[model samples]
Target: MQWLFGSDEDILKLVGRRGSFLSRIGVAVGIKDSDFPVFRELYYEFMEQFKSRYSVYTPRRVFASVDVRGILIDGSELKEYMLFLRDFVNDVVNTSGLYVNFVFASFGTSRISLPGKAKPVSVKTFIESTLKSYFAYIPVWTVIHRTGIKRARVYVDSFSTSPETPAWNELCNNNEVYVVSNGDKVNLLISAADLLLGYIGTIIKLRNKKPDISELKSYLKPFGFNDDRFRIYHVGNRDLGHIIYKDPTVKINPLLYRPFPIVYLIPELSPAGLLAGKDERKLIESSHVYEYILRYVEEQEGSLKIISFTEDFKHLSAGGVVVSLGEHSRRIAEYLRLLGFPLEHLNARELIHLYGGDPRL
Candidate 1:
């Protein structure tokens, strides 16, 4: 099956008692090609409804880009914004033939700086960097890896200047990537991406305020916005590079489970447990091991079962492979190592090569 991916960004500059800073939010959505007609119908209906309510004309292509910001101009318009988003999300979720997946990344601009340059980089450079680090490479690779699809098409709303870096070129070489202008006649998914970006940007702005947004948060839960699909790299004054919020109940490649179980021993304060606080970087580093193992098992058609380091050994089957993640589980790893299992610090790629196997598999 073919997948269409679209991306857009919302940049916000805020000034408060804590001082002024910038927040850049990039959102991407992936939809099946078979579902685009239904999505287009829903989008057109929403635009017509919006135009009737506000008495504002919404051109076919630029409806979301030009009109979504108008809904955020004041407090009174917030109600309409919430209602619009609520109805849109509800309708999309209830639709039978549509499958939409969303992924968003937020970068806090306060602690960002070039390594050697004294002066700051231009807005275009920042945009390119955000796209490279979070938007382009990871999102496309995640889709390809999860779906086992050979190729997917990506349509990014034009940033005026296209990225020319080697990473960007490599991405294009691997998949069909296009940077299309807002007025592009065939790029309907870009408008959906823009709408999502605007809604998420509003959530970031009001999250710290006294006004409660429980209802808004609730609306996004169905879209998996509060789950693994959402990632916050940096926010406010903190440079939190590794704090990823993912639901523990969600397993990687749920449908590809085999009877042979690979047990993963996690730290007591693992990111999956939502307790990675100040040790987020270390925890995230160790998470790569779990990710690698999970991917390997997925390719092997095996299953993975996660357990805390302090959990009992009752769940471990005889002669099963057990792997420990993070420094906190070092002792357990050592014990398992002595029992003839693989090392806890093993690299899956190197190990596969050592066994004269295909590393890609």
Candidate 2:
């Protein structure tokens, strides 16, 4: 049968859960750690060489290396042939270099969940566990199905695993199977994974296809990916209640202009800006509204999913109320304002009552 299904000989793949983009999880096939160092050097070398010949950093020049955001040329036929891979990865896998087969998969937030959880997991735990479950099962899948491969090595792109993973435990029992993490490096394979995932994630972002997986299949065609190996693994979460960005690997580039929201203190709602000596007990008693707003910010703090140029014109209103918890409020607001966010301060009572409810400030 085709490698698409199962293979007869032992096969190995180095893989990583590429990035936790705000919307999806990008998965990449792997390269052996033993050969990664050499591969990484050549990869960067080729990028520099290409940069000298054709600049990729600037889009102002002819051909621009890009038209709008997408590349103007495929460059797939070039002798180097790897320039098609950019954004998330920069390394090259050339003729002399070990060319690790690149396969990719993406699971959107509204689709996949932590194996057992009912809700989409919190960002931190989501990052750690998702890949382990997927990476661990592939070899077992091939073996159980009688794919000819008798042995396999699955290298993962992770730094630590506290409790032993179920797949790791399974591999220990079988001499023919194994799994390992690379301690989270920017080595060749992970870099490539980054590129591949970033490409798909960008597509989802551009299309604004939140909660829809129908168009995802068409994206695989350009990559020549038709095999089950490139499983979309599309699951569904209809009311996913405010998905915070999961994978940090592929996220908004800070250099780009994006709205930076900051939590702020309410003046009229607060009713305390003029108080000289604040009573600690009364302060606590009066600040429950602040407590609620602060709680909301904590959960959604790191999730700046980013807006494209097309969205740049939209008004980004950031003058939401955050309680002045101490000396920190003014400082944080000043810093965010310097970064170009449109922010405003309000009294907790004003903000609360504006929403047609008594803040009880």
Q: lDDT at 292 for candidate 2?
A: 41
Model 1 is weakest, by summed lDDT over 10 consecutive residues, at 250-259
Candidate 2, 161-239: lDDT as tens digits: 2333433344334423322121111123333444444454544544444323445666534544434334444322421
lDDT of 2 at 192: 45
Off by over 4 Å in 1: 13-21, 53-62, 71-76, 93-150, 183-186, 209-361
| lDDT over C-alpha atoms for residue 70 of model 2 | 40
lDDT at 59, model 1: 28
Model 2 ranges off by over 4 Å: 1-24, 30-45, 50-150, 171-186, 210-214, 223-231, 234-361
The TM-score between candidate 1 and the true structure equals 0.47
Each candidate's TM vs. the true structure? 0.47, 0.33
Per-residue accuracy of model 1 over 19-109 as CA lDDT, tens digit each: 6444455555676688777877776676677767777532232346445556545755676676576566566523523333433333435
